[model samples]
Target: MAVDDSSTDPDGGSESESSASGPSRSPSDSVSAVARSVADPILEIRDTTVAFNMDRGESRVLDDVTLDIERKEIIGIVGESGSGKSMFASALLDAVVEPGVLTGDITYHPTPDESIDLLNLSKRELRDLRWEEISMVFQGAMSSWNPTMTIRGHFEETLDAHDADYVAGMERAHELLSDLYLDPERVLSSYPHELSGGMKQRALIALSMVLEPRVLVMDEPTAALDLLMQRSILKLLKEVQSKYEITMVFITHDLPLVAELADRLAVMYAFQFAEVGPTETILRDAAHPYTRSLLNATPNLDADVDEMKPIPGSSPDPVNAPVGCSYHPRCPLATEQCVEQDPPFFDAGPNHQTACFHWEEAAEEIPFSLPEQTDREASR
Candidate 1:
């Protein structure tokens, strides 16, 4: 549902501005968002766009995507199934598939004066960056493994591809697996079919961390796992990050999960971000109606059943989304202006922003005090 920063026609701009989006092309341009003092900017996406050509017309899946990843930051992208959350992270890692065109500036400031434009890189160059510089733990970890290869061999093969020797790599892999609470010998020698779902999940994470890259992009790493497995995996992931100092981009539809892991969050809808800011402020003090609906729909353990808020209607059609405000049709506070002119992303605070025109007026209702909840009261 989305494309990365490398292949698309960016917004409100000429090709000259976006030439840097490609790996081989560097634009003679500057951006206000760029900060040279930030030595650890693992990646950045500016005005990224992606489109899918269909019989009807070109469907814009991503519109002006931007990324500013610093060291050790856990950024969570939350949205519905088709919200293009996956596309943003996938594109950042240069793991985008074909037929999906990406356009925009993706600057990876790997070294000062030496930025890697993922969009312009050759396929081989992109592939090289995948395992060695940037790694991913995809949604279905078990399926990603090979049934034909032994777990030990599979892990070794992954490391071997990066020119890492088997003996030393295996030792490191063993250590990582142990850290994830998996028994080294049995897990290494077992086939993919032999290992349980959770074990395979941990093993997938182990492989991603085996290289210990600077940025680790995970797409719903706990999607189908049980609560116990989810907690176990999250705990292990935190531990590994502490040891490796890996930056993370967690792509999922779960908000509570964001609260637990993310330092900042960005909410996307119909291929664009509705809001982006600090997790606590955005969650408790959201300004956009879309974000408010999402927060309200969160099952409150303490709220009475009738007091809960339910989001109205489904997302707009991605193929031909609304012209002005993408969420206008379903937004409770939508007006004539919202239906006529698309609201630009506006900063609400130091590191907070919302794309809603009524941000100021909507803030109070969005973060109402519900007095006290029975869940917390009883627990105390």
Candidate 2:
């Protein structure tokens, strides 16, 4: 059967992994390449839900999350801890462990029109697409390397898998490591345990780029690094983005960093997206209460802030999440409607969407303020 991978309906039906045959270039692939029109979405996800089956029961990790990532643009997925950030990335990469069920649409655009439903591909086809078409640099990913293997051996394995020349791959690795300001010789010769945390992390980034995939998904790539190292890593990422022209999906809990680097921001809460829009729009006038809370919680250097306001209340457990809005319990402006019914993502502004019933009101309100922290505690 002929599968047109280059085309997809925005309102497409769910595709099961078993339904697809071996992957082949779609008919529209050439046509889209010739067009080369304005910026087009490279990846589009709609109603993606991921669930994990445990000894107790089934726990929904991600709930009906939808997002669109454009070509060569950086999309930041920001959220608190245990808010399904990593799980969301895992879903896109089909890296979710067994006993985990993924549902809904996840489309990957290799070219302008060439769209491959990631969830629809067979295991073999999906394996071929990963790293070759898309790559991921995971958090605490340094441990992923074989402790017994030399860094050079790791690169050899990666290049050999994709059927690329080991010599050329080593040369490419040297260039990337040098660009990232690392001593390529020492890095390649050293094992994972020998290098510093930051070095290991940067090595992972270089390794992921061996194939020069169009899309690079970084799951909190700098979380383990200190502030200075984090800045350095972020700078390197920006350079990589410009030089390779790769679209990136950076997942992190650091709202400030996201605002600084991301072209667009998607705020995730509980198991769903609370808001998604341009960085400026979200920073200047956030529409969702949760988005506002996140902004408020983040300390602003420009303003004379006395204290670091923390968002009150802990996030609900995914296994038994609240009925309507998962954030209703924590949302300051949550109403009866919020508790009873899930709010649809409403258009707040140009390219801005928020899943809050009182979005308009929240948009108009000033950023919230919290009780000040004491000097004794601040000293720490």
In the range 1-380, model 1's lDDT, one tens digit per residue, is 11111222221111111223321122111232222213356677777877777777777767666646666878788887777777777678766566777777787765545688878889788877888778898777668787899988888778878787777888889999999999999998899999888999998888887876778889888898887787677767777887877888888888766566677787888778777667776766776788888877876655677766777877765577787887888887888988898776554554555677777767665554333432213323
Quick one: best lDDT, which candidate?
A: 2
TM-score of 1: 0.85
Q: lDDT of candidate 2?
A: 0.74
Worst 10 residues of 1 by lDDT: 8-17
Model 1: runs farther than 4 Å from truth?
Answer: 1-40, 111-113, 367-380
Clashing pairs in 2: 6-114
Q: Residue 139's C-alpha lDDT in candidate 1?
A: 72
Model 2 residue 276 distance off true place after TM-score fit, in angstroms: 0.5
Q: Write the per-residue lDDT of candidate 2 for residues 62-114, one digit (tens) a residue.
A: 87666667789898888888888888888888877766788888889899868
